[model samples]
Target: MEITAEEMKKSIEKIYERLDEVSPVDFDCGKLCGEVCCKDLEGEGELALYLLPGEELMYEESDEFELYYIDSSEIKYPHSWKGQIYLVKCVNPPRCDRSIRPIQCRTFPLIPHITKNGEFHLIFDETEFPYECPIVRDHIKLNHDFLKVTYEIWMKLITNPLVYDLIDMDSRMRDNRKTNYEIVV
Candidate 1:
């Protein structure tokens, strides 16, 4: 079943609200890594985060962030995805509107994973980044509420087939490559 744009907008709003209630750690995790995720540091490629299906509705063309649309065919996304995918880059590194951050920013350090047996889990994000995330590299113990809420949000997110296919595609690739990931939830 296809989701309408309005439905997708409402769902994204609810996700942001739910995620706002918890954080990965009691203190700002960025303090440990100097917010590297948001910065395009010297010698590293420009930092950008892709918006999930229909998530581009959350933002407008602004001075703080530059939004670029790429043809889905040009990228290695799931076959289920088509048309333009939105990628946003912060114009001013590590300083932007926090309340309206993308879901990817809201759920850093943990990524949704689905096993071959079809079990959904939240695992430490193993994607290679220009700079290491302290939470992942140090194996920091995340707040229980943060983990639980993030897991619940992901469970709801995958109900959208687009999101499901994305997670499934990544999970299958990981399984095929025998990539190591530490499951958190």
Candidate 2:
């Protein structure tokens, strides 16, 4: 079932509602690593974040993000994906509205996976990142509530086929890379 733009707006908002109050730790995790993850956006045309399919409904040209669209043919995308994918570069980082942070920003240092058998798992993000996230690098202990909410959000998000395919593709890539990261939950 393809999610409509209105439905996607509601779903993304629901995710925001659950994650708005939590952080990986009680304090600013960025300070521990000098905000490396957020600071990476400072470079000229160097950093952009990909929004999941249908997530573009949540933003507009006047928002804090400068949006760009790339043809799927020009980048590596899931076999199931077609046309262009929207990428957003944050105009302000490490200081945006915490409640409306993109899903990628909200779920940092953790990645979601659904096994072939349909079981869900949360793992320390195995994707290659441009900057070192201390939380993942040092195996930081995340707040239990943060972990729970993030896991729950991803589980819900994957019900959309496009999201599921995207996660599955990344999960397969991670498997091919043979990362030995431990599952968070």
Candidate 3:
């Protein structure tokens, strides 16, 4: 699955533009009153690691590893690979293929909200095994430069006009509307 240089460039450009949008905004990750969510069990399910469309193209082309999406549905990853992955370390996620990682990864630790008419907003989802995510806790401090940059990058990616275009394409592909268990890759 060789990728065209132009497409690769487009991916990098889009990602760079997005990276500049999601600035890491320092915020509190609520204490875990019970079991350590991410620590003990590095949560499974797509919601735990959703990847929007087109994000997989690069990964597929690169052949770094194989992890399929639930379907072409944007952001609806019902179940992703949950192999014996280690947690409890200062581990940065697998180095995302600069051109392949999903927009969600670009906007990590932050959730995207789109209105019915099609307006995007950046919202944080700190409900997961957050206590286990050091970045969500003391590791990433408020007003930190990196976090600020991440916050901005996420903001722009959500508000970027192209989001609608992507959504429109997704809608067309999703017309059939039947649940697809197999990922496109």
Q: Which candidate achieves the best lDDT against the true structure?
A: 1
TM-scores, one per candidate: 0.95, 0.88, 0.43
Better of 1 and 2 by TM-score: 1
Q: List the residue pairs that clash in candidate 1.
A: none
Which digits, one per residue and each the tens of the lDDT, describe model 2 over residues 1-185?
A: 76577887887788777888788898888788787666544344467789987667667633666777899889888877899898876667655555556798898878887666767799887567667788888888999989988988888888778889888887877777776768787
Ranking by lDDT: 1, 2, 3
Candidate closer to the true structure by lDDT (higher is better), 1 or 3: 1
lDDT by residue (1-185, candidate 1, tens digit) is: 76788887888889999999999999988899888788888988788888988778777746788888999999899988989989888888888888778898898889999999999999999888888898898899999999999999999989888899999999998988999989999
Q: Supply the global lDDT for candidate 3.
A: 0.42
Once fitted onto the true fold, the runs of candidate 2 whose alpha carbons sit more than 4 angstroms away are 1-4, 41-45
How far is each candidate from the true structure, as Cα RMSD in Å?
1.4, 2.2, 10.8
| 2 versus 3: better TM-score goes to | 2
What candidate 1 gets wrong by more than 4 Å, as runs, is 1-4
TM-score of candidate 1 on Cα atoms, chains taken together: 0.95
Off by over 4 Å in 3: 1-9, 17-48, 72-100, 114-121, 138-152, 159-185
Collision count for each candidate, in order: 0, 0, 19
Q: After aligning candidate 3 to the native by TM-score, how far in Å is the CA of 33 from where it should be?
A: 18
lDDT score at residue 49, model 3, on the 0-100 scale = 41
User: Order of all candidates by TM-score, from best down to worst?
Assistant: 1, 2, 3
